[model samples]
Target: MTEHPDHGFLTEPEVTPEVRASYDSDVADHGYVMNLSRVWAHSPAAHDRLFELLADLARLGGLTFRQRGILVSAMASTAGDSYCALAWGGRLATEAGDAVAGSVLHHDDAGLEPADAALAAWARAVTRDANATTAEDLEPLRAAGFDDRQIFAITAFVALRRAFSLVNDALGVRPDRQLRDDASPTVREAVSFGRAPADRPS
Candidate 1:
């Protein structure tokens, strides 16, 4: 594994204007540079593209914010990514209530609407074993009233989220301290199956 980087941004000589711009937005949005953004600082182009994909999905509006959170939590939990699970699971808790968010992360889709449940299942399947998903796997989504375009958008969003999780998990980017400290107990407890922020070697 690549050792965790010491600086939040690249050294001045290596820093590009685009990188600085991205960092500036992170600070403005969250009052600090998120660990994931710092990891992406090494490649500003890739960072920009990842956020662009997120923005495109936001514009699609095929899913509500709460549904997106459930999907993200399901994917992150299935991928065994603690960083995303804590961060997005916290967001899911905020948007959908803690119990609902925790249930999604724990793979219990009991109270979710049929469509939301289908999306959650599909996200977990895609994250865990996309190759194993057959046409039958998509039937639930269709039955739940999702059109082809919506299904396409949801799949794209899941893939993009997995890309972000892969990069963070592979690079050993620890979850931000604020996320670890501030996440609800339910969210914190639900995402217990991956490398932890405290596991980073000194």
Candidate 2:
């Protein structure tokens, strides 16, 4: 097992082939092992399964990269999870724009189009309190042209993201330094809550 002083709350797990593969994938994607990946390395199978399900839901919903960014940013911000907010906000900045991504992170959907705005609103509602959401909450999504299947997929997507965020936040997993450095100034400014970025990249 490779251990780092600042790698979340749990003790580092032994580097089995599964954990090594997870780290390799992170390096391939981001040029470094992400702090979140370090934490999830404890159970690489579970991590892979969660992401697989997320991918399936995304495909079922016909989600574009931008739409996924919106859903993740909105859900993370609403749930007070700065790690995802920063990560997705940076991605959203590239797909949308810095101001728009920052706006979504701040829960100000003014910069979004009607359909995107509807998605953001739905994500927030679901993250804030799923029980508080009524059938009426689906109206805006319907008005924005989403059919029942898409709506269901979108709801499930937000819920799954919330589940991911909950675990990271509860475990004291800080956002990676690369995420903070990569995020636009607008995005950095918008993410004002939850755990801070790690002192250095993992």
Candidate 3:
């Protein structure tokens, strides 16, 4: 077992087969078990299922990697979730560039194309208050060429991402050190809210 400290407010959990699988997946992708993985390992099955649903939504929405990054960064930043903001902001930087990613995190869509800008705005609206959104709020997405199905998918995607962020934030899960360290300086600077990153794993 990796000798890391407890992930969040909860104590470290025993490494059951499911938990080990979750840890292994994290290690395979990131070269270390992420702090969030440790926290989610308490319910590895639920964690896996949540990601599977996210994947399904992404696929159904026909979302490109860059689009996913834009949606996540915009939504996370709007919701004050530093963990997802840093993680997806770093990815958006890779896909779109640091300036664009930083702009999205800062809630400025000036750097994005028309469609992406609309997407980012929609994400923020959803995060800020879903009920506050009206048909008028979705007009830009329609004008930007997103069909009703795609718009529905985008809305669901933001909602699901919000749910994930809620769990991590409410449970006191700090952003992983690796996530913070790996983020571009622009992303790190933009992610000024939410729980601070965990200390480096010993």
Among all candidates shown, the one with the greatest lDDT: 2
After superposition, the stretches of candidate 1 with alpha carbons farther than 4 Å from their true spots are 1-13, 198-202
TM-score of each: 0.88, 0.96, 0.95
Residue 126 accuracy (lDDT) in model 2 = 91
Give a tens-digit lDDT track for model 3, residues 20-49.
Answer: 888888888889887788778889999988
Alpha-carbon runs more than 4 Å astray in model 2: 1-4
Model 3 CA lDDT for position 154: 85
Residue-wise lDDT of candidate 1 within 73-96, one digit each (tens)?
999999998888988899989987
Candidate with the larger lDDT of 1 and 3: 3
lDDT of 1: 0.80
Clashes of each: 0, 0, 0
Candidate 3 residue 73 C-alpha distance from true site, Å: 0.5
C-alpha RMSD values across all candidates: 3.2, 2.6, 3.1
